[model samples]
Target chain A: MNHFIIKNRKDVQKLSTLAIFAGKTMLSNGAETYRVEDTINRICSSKENIKEVDSFVTQSGFFLTLEYEGEIFTYLKRVKDVGINLNKINLVNDFSRQFVNQDISLEKGMKTLDEINNIPGYPKYLKILGGSYVSGFFSLMYGGSPQDFLPSFIASFISLIILDKLSKFNLTFFIDRFIGAFLSSLLAIFAVKLGIGVNLDKIIIGSIMYLVPGVSITNSIRDTMSGDSLSGLSKGIEAILSALAIAFGVGIVLNLKSKGWI
Target chain B: MSVLLQFMYSFFATIGFAIYFGAPVNSIIPSGISGGASWSLYYIMFSILNDKILATFMGAFLVGTLGEALAIKYKKPATVFITPGIVPLVPGAGMYYTMSYLVGRNFNKAINAGTEVFFMAAAIAMGIIVSTIFTRTIRRFKRQN
Candidate 1:
């Protein structure tokens, strides 16, 4: 006996939308493509409402098919503005778990998803302060002397501010990172030239950690190891590109300095 | 000791990064600890073995392991912790040096630095893969038991 629950088209739409909402949250918040696909599968595997879900996830969007009561429904969600917001990922993961356990109603679920999706990130002030700490301490660890600490910290703080301001204008991610990195290295070089720091290399490296693709590279490795080859490759490429952009930004500034153009 | 101090600094740096990464409030401290431990492990391993890549691999492995354990304990995904944990081993310095040399038209140094960065990235990937496989097998064993 085939015992899949009968769901109306309206119900299918709601549930699929909810699943897509969860998926968009995951993708936007830096969840690997495989994790996003698994979560979608779990959400759609409700014995009561749906029988199966086939989902295809990429770096930018997702396509999902929901099969229920001998009917098929498909959804395509375009994911824009990808950035790391782990809090959103955790929230979506929690909501998905609750949903899979049949602990939340459809309307309630929709409401919660919207709320989590719109949750405010940490304040800019705090972000700049954190950047300061990263630059100041990482420089010391990277072999910079105490004199370089203040320069690195100041440079990184300014870079974070520039990043925040530029991103607000809805600029592309590459440009945002490129310009953020350019300002960071420029500041570091200027500080070193003016006797603010002895080690330009260490200071520049320290400040650029804020722009490094550390998290992305780690996720790419995890995704690849877990057999999500496409996701791994896409994320790996993204990491490389971002790393290259940072390098380019720094290189430009250093070249100008070397050529007495700065 | 200075190693301990380095650990604390790395710890503090990661906490800041965790916040910026928007880690959940409760997991923030644990992620920071994970990041710091990974960095300090690399430092200690490098001091003993005098090899940057080996130290990075060991540190990355431990980071993956710790991240898995924390993910289980907190009922959250492992990426939450592991993403920020490997910051210290991501070869940011190597990438910068390579670019610097390349821009300055120093071909030999650029090649050396670029190759070093490439290898370091590979090692970090290897380390994460090893630990992820180990953890999956361990989890499966528990399930079988």
Candidate 2:
């Protein structure tokens, strides 16, 4: 049976060290799932006689579920030669350097979020619109079907326009969400009616990705896995709440449309 | 010629991501080259198998293994260099789009796109986890001797 399993605590520690290091890299680079998956693959392939591998990345981190179909002793000898150490992982360093950066004053934080909301003129809105348009174009170029691209483009454009015309106020977490989802639904309907052959799935999903909270969720999970439970919890909650906000925004717009309100 | 261009795109795209993510420009070349080679493998597998999931893992494995070799030589975290190389292949934004669309409306289209994203994620995750476990377990059994 060829598999990568840690029979003792030392091996577990070694793997953890690599995971912590890899988690840091994943967190910094927008915390995309692919990076996290790639890191796990890198770690597993580091050893010798690794035949037949499988792995999974959850919010928790990478867990290697492998099957070893190679000679045992030679593989152990190679593993010993790798010079991996559990103590060198610097759990504290990883947390402090990456996860601890979020301690900001409420005043400053709110102000920044406010600025993002309150910026006058349509240029910023158009910029977002333009980003969506290009993103759709790139998405199509990269193999998205026309059914996916056309509707998403219209939805993005309309949503941005609606967002632009809406009154800029001091944004609250909840209110921002309401506006976002409301506009998304409107854009979606417009796209649907325009006969652009839009797929509702494509437009809504593409629009939301611009602000999806992937990095935070990945980081929170990484922190918790590395033993920074408190920070991880906070970050996790933040990520989840933000996701909920987007969901709420999208939901409201959807519900409104069902009610024929807009 | 087009395949060659796609390889270059994957290669350059990986390098650009590496720099953007804080890797030095000096190391970017080797990293990109490795990533490009891996993507070439991916292109081959995807073309042959016509399975994006299989292609993703195989390409990812190649990139990761080659990246580990590079890390041993360079003494930096394999992730710093390897991640950028594989990222272009990961479907992050794609999955999110699928999900949001499902939530909004269009059940049929949403299900189609969403399933693709879900399977891709699952496939990638399974590949990484299984590979790691396989390596670790083999070593443990070897140690008993």
Leading candidate by TM-score: 1
What DockQ does candidate 2 have relative to the true complex?
0.08
Q: What is the C-alpha lDDT of each candidate?
A: 0.85, 0.51
Candidate 2 at A120: error in angstroms?
32
TM-score of each: 0.95, 0.43
Q: Encode model 2's per-residue lDDT on B18-125: one tens digit a residue.
A: 443335435678777876777677778888999888887777667656655675576555444555555545554455455456656778887876677666645544
User: What value of lDDT does candidate 2 attain over all alpha carbons?
Assistant: 0.51
Q: Which residue runs of candidate 1 sit more than 4 Å off their true CA positions?
A: A1-7
Highest-scoring model, lDDT: 1
Weakest lDDT window of 10 consecutive positions for candidate 1 chain B: B13-22
Candidate 1's residue-wise lDDT over B65-88, tens digit each? 999999999999999999878887
DockQ-based CAPRI category assigned to the predicted complex of candidate 1: medium
Q: After superposition, how far is residue A244 of candidate 1 from its true place, in Å?
A: 0.8
